[model samples]
Target: MNTKPRQTGRGGPRGTKNLPPAPDNKENIDTQILRLEQLEQKFNVEGSNTLDIVYARQENDQHHATIQAQAAELERLKEIVASFHASEGALGPNITPSGSAAAGSTQDAPKKDKARKHSAAANVDDMALDERASKGQIGAESQPSGKKGKAPKPSAPTNVDDMAIDAPDGAAAVAGTGADDEGVSDTTAALARENAELKRLLAAAQAGPVGGPAEEGPAPGSIPRPKGSAGSDFNIQDAMGLGHGRKNRKNYKSIMRSCRDLVLQARIDWERPWAEVSAATKSKAFAVAEERHPILARFFNSWATEELMKQSVKNKRNRAYKHDGLEVPEKYAYLKANAAKRNPTAPRGRQAKLGRVDVARKRAEKKKKVATSSIKTKKDAKGKGKAVAPESDEDDVEMKQYAPSEEDESDCTY
Candidate 1:
């Protein structure tokens, strides 16, 4: 048939613009899809990285917080220990912590406390024994001295009054024979007076009618009778009681002082750990001193003292070198230098004096003196040699109206 190749108009001539626009919409859709996929992937990657960073920061913060909490807890514990030690001092060593006892036992709390005290005393004795043994003080059976499987005999109570009385015998002898004879004479006089007083009292009793109970006298072996009957037995008893009371009070005061010393020692022991911790954390020697000696807290406050500041600087330097393996920065050096400047006694180089203001003042004074001298000379010259009187009388000579004397010519021969 003559209509063989009817134009289908699908594939036109090569390189023609009508060659089917290359599926532009599909290609564009594909390119847009690829860009969107790439953007999604990038967003996912960045979001994951940001989340990782956030999680890492959170972890770091938690770690730091935990460390801080631990440090705070340690400090709190130290404070608690210190408070306990202080309270223990006010309370005697026999005190027990609350809630340390249980019910239903036949022994009451006081008894339990007593038993505990005895147990502690026994332990202390054992420790002392151990110490003695370590020092080669053991006996035949390795028992401590004064403890040979038997209780020690009770010791007689020592009378301090008797000791004091005895102590004066040697002193009295050293006072010389004259003083010793005077003391004996006084004793004899006191005895004679006492005898006369007793006799007078007996006479008074006899002069009064018989029955008045014969007036009992002081017991034998009591203090030597006083010279006057006014000194009654009651006086001696009262004096003895007063002396005993004074002794008791003195003993009580001594006990209190001892307790205070023990409390101080306990406080020192309790604060040792705190001092170490403070030194480790703050790297400050003052903290250690304050922890060790609470009484010195006020003194340490003004750590600006030259010695203390120097020690602190040394501590910081050592800490920096120890922990960070680094030298002190130049900024710190400048601060230290300024501090030294503020303290006149701080060690400094002689070079610091080379450009001092004192030198400048001296130089300025010399220059001013020179300028004043020059001005004075100009003033003197401007006076026009008008027979200006000499400043000194020695320079002003009275020249008599006469020819040169013959003696002047004789002196000129030399």
Candidate 2:
């Protein structure tokens, strides 16, 4: 069979031409956002993404509502403009065309009163017609005069204190003239009452308790932050850090100190020495060692490790001093003495405790002791143990045997 490419329309998809044209970019973006929101709702992503999506949708809804309100207001304004235009068109000619005649006839005193009444009547008639048209009475007038709808008539206005009163212009004008000060006083009183209520509500919200007094609560937006709580404000960098599991850098020195204190406390509280109980209670806290709990084992192990590390460092430092042919510092003098004590042949005493400087002085003292012993021996030889000349054959033999050789005699003379 010969293979050939099947032709489709220029639109690229077979059934796409029948689909409604895609909206503008802004509308399409909104549609996509809505779809995404629905998807997010149906299959929620963990963490802050869900919260962000919700907040965005709420803001979008608020903006849309405000835009719709503004649009309705614009339409209402257009209708009012159209009504004003209609009224002006109907009344414009009557007012302007007769203006010059009225001015000239001002001298005709008798006709002036009639012209003024006609003008006043015309204005009243125009206002009445406008009001009737606005009130939807034009429909009533178009119906047959004899046929009236039996729809319930509007009841007379009530003068109850509970009901809000909407007085006509004449009534309102009369009230304003008669009780202007009273009206002003009432408005001020109402405003003051409203202000007090608002303050009370605000105080209650800040206080945290509904029944708590306003004075007891912290100032709004000024609540003291909880200790050890995470920060509220965050950024993209923080999100990245969280994704990778942010690390907390610890000061090992401080950690060692804290662990050491805890271990010491545990030992004291349990009334057992560290070495004796470490193996048995190593898996338990010192506080509750009898219970054999392992909660504090980690801390105990950390402290033990820190001690071992410290000993290792000390040994290394001592080795470094020896390698460099330098004397150990005074602080390490105790360690030097302790090591010497460990040897079986090492001498002990104040000299053992002495540092390198004192040990050198001790060597000089030993030399002086040898010189003093030699001086004592020479004095004893000259005074009490004097030599005698040989007289007998046996004495001569002894003399010959004990006497210094010729080489010793020469060395003695020197």
Candidate 3:
């Protein structure tokens, strides 16, 4: 508001002219502030999506580890069951209801041998008592010799359990194991069978859907009747889509690998309660998909799948997709490669196949090492006297570089 100009030194403003130029640090601070502002703007727009991707990756890794552990546990259980069956088989064919050696002409010989052992043991005990008495280790009144006029009644066990233990090993073995074996074997067999069935279902679930034409009744006498009807003719390979006439080995490998991830995700999600599928769960599921197969990750997320399911569900009231009950997609329908390779005769993308992940650099390096090991072995053989260096500790060995190909934006949903 001042109309009069302020008077200063010859440079116009003396204090301003003398002031030092802005420091390098001050310019850097300003640049950093601007970058931070831009970053904050980005976070406001895409924060949810970014967070979801991270969560999904973690879920996928955890799922894979769990499935691997389960498979190992199942294998161990099978081994235990097998050992039980073998031991039961080897227990000898002469087992009786009481679990004792069967009563036959051969049984008398064992009884005779046991009687001799008892008499020998009794004589040894008598000898020990006489020696103890002579040495004044026992009181004369307690000596067996003092009661010589009457034969000592054989010592009897006070309890049934004691009597069982006192019996011949063969007799006790039979008595203890006979009934228990039947019951235990029955229970174990049933449990093993159930576990096997469950494993089969899990493996099947991870594979592609079964493919076969509906079976019609066979003509009269067209085939011999089996004792039992085969409920489902499909095998695991058929379920895995390997039953196709022309095989694409690459595609098969790809499907198998992706199927493992899908199965793992399904397992983790399926265990949680269906009612708990809120925004958080939805975000997690989306993130997990994005972490692995970014191309199809969005398709399996809550928003995408829920929208897809709305039209498919019989009841409109049940609009939400059950997070835990997700199934592996039938085909890799979303992939550009799969879509391009589809048969012209069939609907576009309908018959699309799964695409394999690009082979990683570490895997390629491993293959190279394997190939070169033979040459090294030949050299070692030719120079037997040459001192070879001890191998470096595995801890000190450099780990291979690994880079997984990220899916391009062609498959992006949003």
TM per prediction: 0.18, 0.18, 0.18
- The residue-by-residue lDDT of candidate 2 on 194-231, one tens digit each, is 55665555454444334544565344433232323122
What are the candidates' C-alpha RMSDs?
A: 43.2, 34.3, 35.2
Which residue segments of model 3 deviate by more than 4 Å?
Answer: 1-49, 93-278, 281-414
Off by over 4 Å in 1: 1-288, 291-295, 298-311, 314-348, 351-358, 383-414
Query: Pairing residues by index, what is the TM-score of model 3?
Result: 0.18
lDDT string, candidate 1, 1-414, tens digits: 585444444655445655576565467457644754565575565334332333345568879997776666656655655664464344333322221223333244556544333323223223334444555544423333475688555332243233325533321222224433355335435545755665565454435334557555544443332332222222322322222677755543333333233223223222122333333223233333343334223332322111233333444455665696766556557655544544466323333332343455555566566667766776778767553332433211322212233333222210
Model 1 steric clash pairs: none
Model-by-model lDDT, in order?
0.40, 0.42, 0.42
Q: Could you tell me how far off, in angstroms, the CA of residue 68 lies in candidate 3 after the best superposition?
A: 2.0
Q: Count the backbone clashes (under 3 Å) in each candidate.
A: 0, 0, 7
* Clashing pairs for predicted structure model 3, backbone only: 52-287, 56-287, 56-288, 99-174, 100-174, 269-324, 270-324
Q: What tens-digit string does per-residue lDDT give for candidate 3 at 1-414?
A: 887656587736446776898667467557645754565475564333433444654778889997887777667666765765565445434443222344454345866333332222223223333444555555333324446587645443333344336544323222234443344344445545866776676565455247897665554423222232121232223333344655544444443344333323333343234344466644554454444434333221233333222222312222232344444344534564654654457322211211111234454566567557756776777776654443443412333212212342233221
Candidate 1, after superposition: displacement of residue 246 in Å? 42
